[model samples]
Target: MSTHPTTARPMDGTARAAELTARTAAGAAELTRRTGTAPCLATVLVGEDPASVTYVRMKVRRCELNGIRSRQVVLPAGTTTDRLVEVVSGLSADPEVHGILLQHPVGAHIDERAAFEAIAPGKDVDGVTMHSFAAMGFGLPGFVSCTPGGIMRLLDAYGVDPAGRHAVVVGRSAILGRPAGMLLLARDATVTYCHSRTVDLPARVAEADIVVAAVGRPELIRGEWIKPGAVVVDAGYNPGNVGDVDFAGAAARASLITPVPGGVGPMTVAVLLEQTVRAAAVQLGEDPAALGL
Candidate 1:
């Protein structure tokens, strides 16, 4: 809990993401040159949640910039789960759609899981399907959840190996916290998951070499709880650009910490684009690495 200032370096996810995006763009271009069609991503939006709409718009813009085609499908908020699933299934079966992204929080009554499961595993670029989860958990060759995958890329870019380290992830949501812990474990890190039922969460965070704040609470992980020199990655993006970790406090103790707005957020979209290109390359009978992905 030392308040003294420390020389903590910020994990520059923006720069890292830019580098990845550049590589993916080249891959997409190369794939397009080889094949007659460009890599296409189908984005399905149910209802017009302002935030979700903005997110999808940003993703579509990125696809345009990266030489990937984007198809937008907007449905009414009151759309039935069965109908949504049908739409997703149609997209999954489409040969032109190499990647599928169904914006989350479709609606309260919508069976989000059912819609996600409807996506073909090969086209689940967002990695929301159970097949993607299993692949990530097993370290198999498949798409990773965007945010968790971005976090891993950040760790690698910063030369922070997870092997043999104690990693504590504060949150247990299936997509963010749980998948993050599984990804860390796949890399040989001893992982712990903290949730609403966890007791003395700070104590757990204090013992970790790596701490991931993904509970979607503003500044929930106090700086005092961060172990000295630990790498802190705040994956949660709450209102007003605030993250789950107290960035200022954690920065004082962490050797490396990710910022709220420019850190995990940019990387998530970058991973999605990269995976989309990879999916297209695979579906087009080309090797992803061949295109520099």
Candidate 2:
């Protein structure tokens, strides 16, 4: 007999993503009507990591769906950190580029944080920089890391109030994991941070009213560790389209759980587009609705 992971409800990210995409498409259409040029997102990818390539492509495809044009820059494996920084700085200075998404984990030798900092905060639509992180933590006016932002939106849409809830976030990556915990904490969720060195990871997870599995390791979170009636948000995008949690098992016990491919993935691009239009409007010091106004 096969044992299944326990979960209460399966979170349907694909359906929710579709709704957001439809809304973004309409927003893009309006932006195009007002501004001569369609909202454009500049994407830069370094090296030849298959996952990064695929992710960039996915983001670009979603941009098209939302009527946003994308400008792609594919760099070679031997590209130096200074060269990468120069490229990003140029994008930050570009007037027509409203948003920028730097495909991360360039390489062990590449200075990713330096590259992220090169992007102007206003144009950092992907929210991968320390500036963006602090802004989101302070609840200030800045773009959020798309996947984390999407998860927060999902919670709101499902009416899963985070106030006073025990939220245990696993992982500490700057982009997804760290921001996810910060976002939850900001919502008054009483969050706990867990990483590779975290002791009794299972116990911590079992105590969670809300679980955010963002560690890149596939199936790192076991289903039996989840507390009953808890909501599970998986922000992982591991290779082979696997999530950090065991969805099959977790869904058996979770009140809601996001699927691997369709769950947090599509929402990332949606939030990116949402912020891209805002960035474009801000650059011109004009109201976003003024386009529609």
Candidate 3:
């Protein structure tokens, strides 16, 4: 029903992410120059899921490139929830650590929420805490869950206005889908959340002006279900690097669509690093505004 062009434009997330990362690096360098303290991100990973390990490695590498320091904490798969919480709490208490990121899907037996709460709100750069979720919902200035924050950034970069738009977020995971909808709602978009239990999922998705495919199932959101000219933000990174949306089919119908590897993934890291620099500035008593926060 939309009048926008059917010839879709690929949103160049890689380029935008690079631009933001460069800016963050510059800001980090300046902050370090002023305070003699580089921004530090402490990453905690429980049970080495290969994907999680690779993600953490990528984050650490980006930190190095951006002049931020990374401290790695690796726990065995059998570690208890309490031990994990203690480790995160220890990092939170360390004044030298400016930010904390506990990688997702920390072993099946561990209480993820309890472990996440161990991170101090100020240092939760990954934005997994209840406090961060509240702040995001209220449109307050606080750290956001990285992927959702990155999606917002992508929307802005592409000149997509979210106000009054009907946005369908197709997942409800604590970190990805839920927060993404909240962020969209904060920007004045009308948001509907859909999951496995939702009735007639395709019908619901077709009604959206903006579609965010965050469900882990690859190609779950078929291209035919995309409203013509709608903006599609694919946040899923399934095995084989496929996104939740059928990229080929959706790209034909969407006015703007993100490609799998080059889209949301890069931006996630960029936002994380950017927030780490900001956290450092705040913790060091340096004015974040002065660093172009």
Candidate 4:
């Protein structure tokens, strides 16, 4: 493990993400050179929600810069759940498309689960599907939910081993909280999950050696609740650029902490691109290990 400072040290996720991106770009270029098929990620978007549009554009731009191809499939706001599923299924069946990322909040009416299931497990780079969750739980090979995966990477980069630590994940969202806990458990950590119904949330947080605030509510986990020398990963990005943990207070107590905008956010997209390249390598029948992915 790495030595911890007296005060909280910023995890610097943006810098870490850049490191992953550089490696992924090389893997992507090498894959293309060997197989003549550029790694491609298909992003499916429903409706034109401004935030979603901007996020998709950012992902596409990143893909372009990293030597990965991007294919966008847009659907109307009123598109039926089945229609959305059909589009995703087509992308899954497309041999050239190596990874599938279905942007979420696809309107309240759309069956988001069905749309997610339409993506083949092999191409689920964003890791929203149940198969990915199961894979993560069983320590099998599969793409993980990007945020959770990124969080693990951040922990590894900081040399904070989860083994034998009590990790409290305060959220139960399908893609974030639950998966985060599962990943932690797979690393031999004693994992506890707390959600909206969790009684005395602060008390639960206070006992953790590692705290992951993934619930979207802003500053839900107070700094005073954090144990001294604990590692805090604030995965929440609420409006106004605030995190679930009160930054100043948590930073004062924690040995390591992730900031709101740069901490977990950049790592999500970096992992997405990294996994896309790996997916392409697998689909191309090239060994990812041999390619150094």
lDDT of 2 at 151: 93
In the range 21-92, model 1's lDDT, one tens digit per residue, is: 999999899999999789999999999899999999999999999999999999999999999999999999
Residue-wise lDDT of candidate 4 within 233-270, one digit each (tens)? Answer: 99999889999999999898899999999999999999
Query: Tens digits of per-residue lDDT for model 3 on 18-135?
Result: 9999999999999999999999999999888998999899999999999999999999999999999999999999999999999989888999999999999999899999999999
lDDT of 1 at 11: 95
Clashing pairs in 3: none
**Against the true structure, candidate 1 has what lDDT?**
0.93
RMSD of each: 1.7, 3.3, 1.0, 1.8
Candidate 3 weakest ten by summed lDDT:
1-10
Candidate 3 TM-score, true structure as reference: 0.98
- Residue pairs of candidate 2 with colliding backbone atoms: 5-249, 6-249, 6-252, 6-253, 7-251, 7-252, 7-253, 7-254, 8-253, 8-254
Candidate 2 lDDT over 1-293, as tens digits, reads 01333435556677777887777677677777766668889999998898789888888988887788999999999899999999999999999898999888897888889999999998999998889999989988788899899999889878899999999999888888889988988899899999999999999999999999888899999988988778989887776888899877788888888888878776777788888877877775657665432
Candidate 4 clash pair list: none
The residue pairs in collision within model 1 are: none
How many angstroms is residue 82 displaced in model 2 relative to the true structure, after the best TM-score fit?
0.6
lDDT value for model 2: 0.85
